[model samples]
Target: MLITFKSKSSPEVTMYQEHAERILDVLNKNHTRGVITAAEAAHALQLLEQEVALSKLHPEVDAAHANHSHAHHLQDEDETAEMADKNHIGFAQRAYPLLEMLRAARDGGDNIVWGI
Candidate 1:
């Protein structure tokens, strides 16, 4: 399944259901296929745009590296390696479009709606 976040302010942002669910989970929002208010989108955008060394969005990334003293341990272990890679892909590749959609939705006083 796919979730297409549509808004009046910008072009629609479409993502796989899994990635959308992960984003919603990090924002503490229910993963429902319906309209999301501008206010809610703004709140999510603010957190996404924060100037932090580590984003609160991806805890698994930090936990993966923090598990062992040596960096080689991350490469040696399949779980940690996969976790790190998933975190990187989720935060970097998946989050960008979501952030853009939120920003535009907030700025234009638009609501985002997903699903068919």
Candidate 2:
């Protein structure tokens, strides 16, 4: 499944469900249909920014977290080594589009909704 964020303030942004769910987790939102009203945009942005800041402060944790669920499935040396590679997408990267939308929404008093 895909999560398509709609906002009058910015272009639509689409993300994979997995990545979106992770973002929703960080935002303290349900991993389902929801909206971030203009009124709540600031707080949402702050939460996301804080998480991004924390991720930057602890890059290792970010990488580990991005792959945490998949790590347990590493059944071979090569797989484990591959998991160690620093190529996984971090929270910041995944959150960028939505973050931009949030910024625009916050500025324009627009609402962002997904799964509708």
Candidate 3:
């Protein structure tokens, strides 16, 4: 599975190779205790990417609303900001389960997953 990072700047879908590599390393080392599959890592990484994108978009949307003069556009931007904030929070909430899974897999073995 491929992991990507989303940002509002130039590169929106940057590959999270380092994170993937660390997860793979940990899984490889701890395969005997319990398997941390690629699917789990991919899900976690996708959630993180969405959280990052929402975080980046929130500030940009707020700034655009602040500078704009059109009332209609401002309202839309405000709505968008609220939605993005909710998404960011939702992504974080979703991440906790993945984190707990990773932690449990880690605690079951001697190896630790780094760079997550």
Candidate 4:
């Protein structure tokens, strides 16, 4: 898969490219066969694409708006504390499944199966 960057101003803008063969070589060397499922591979690739896009945009955008690109990072300690006070039950309900899934994966045999 090729990754390209287009700027409003110039054709001279650098377009970063990642060859699939190189990615496959790295993955083959590092991971066991069947350890990463198709969905997981797709999700990882999606995240990588997002990170690359964000890296290209970051310098051009304001810091506050930068966090908007990845919403998960916007949840700060103060936000968590405020959430605990306002909706303890709701917070626990949302958090428990994620915690449980993480625990199960960490104490693993089978790979974690995330819904697509």
What is the TM-score (0 to 1) of candidate 3? 0.27
Query: Scored by CA lDDT, what does every candidate get?
Result: 0.67, 0.86, 0.40, 0.34
Which candidate model has the greater lDDT, 2 or 3? 2
Cα lDDT, model 4, residue 102: 32
Ranking of all predicted structures according to lDDT, beginning with the best and ending with the worst? 2, 1, 3, 4
Candidate 2 per-residue C-alpha lDDT over 1-116 given as tens digits, one digit per residue, 9 for 90 to 100: 88899999999999989888877987777777899999999999999999889988998897777667567777875676586674677888889999999999999999999988
Off by over 4 Å in 4: 1-90
- Residue 95, candidate 1: Cα error in Å is 0.7
- Model 4, 22-114: lDDT tens digits are 223333422112233433544444444444455456533423322333335447856644544453332223223323433344344224331
Per-residue lDDT of 107 in model 2: 100
Kindly give the stretch of ten consecutive residues in candidate 2 with the minimal lDDT sum: 77-86
Candidate 3 segments exceeding 4 Å error: 1-75, 86-91, 109-116
Task: For model 1, name the residue pairs that clash.
Answer: none
Clashing pairs in 3: none
Q: lDDT at 108 for candidate 1?
A: 87
Task: Write down the TM-score of every candidate.
Answer: 0.64, 0.87, 0.27, 0.22
The alpha-carbon lDDT assigned to residue 90 of candidate 2 equals 80
Tens-place lDDT per residue, model 1, 13-70, is 8876766776777676667677768878777776666512254466666344334422
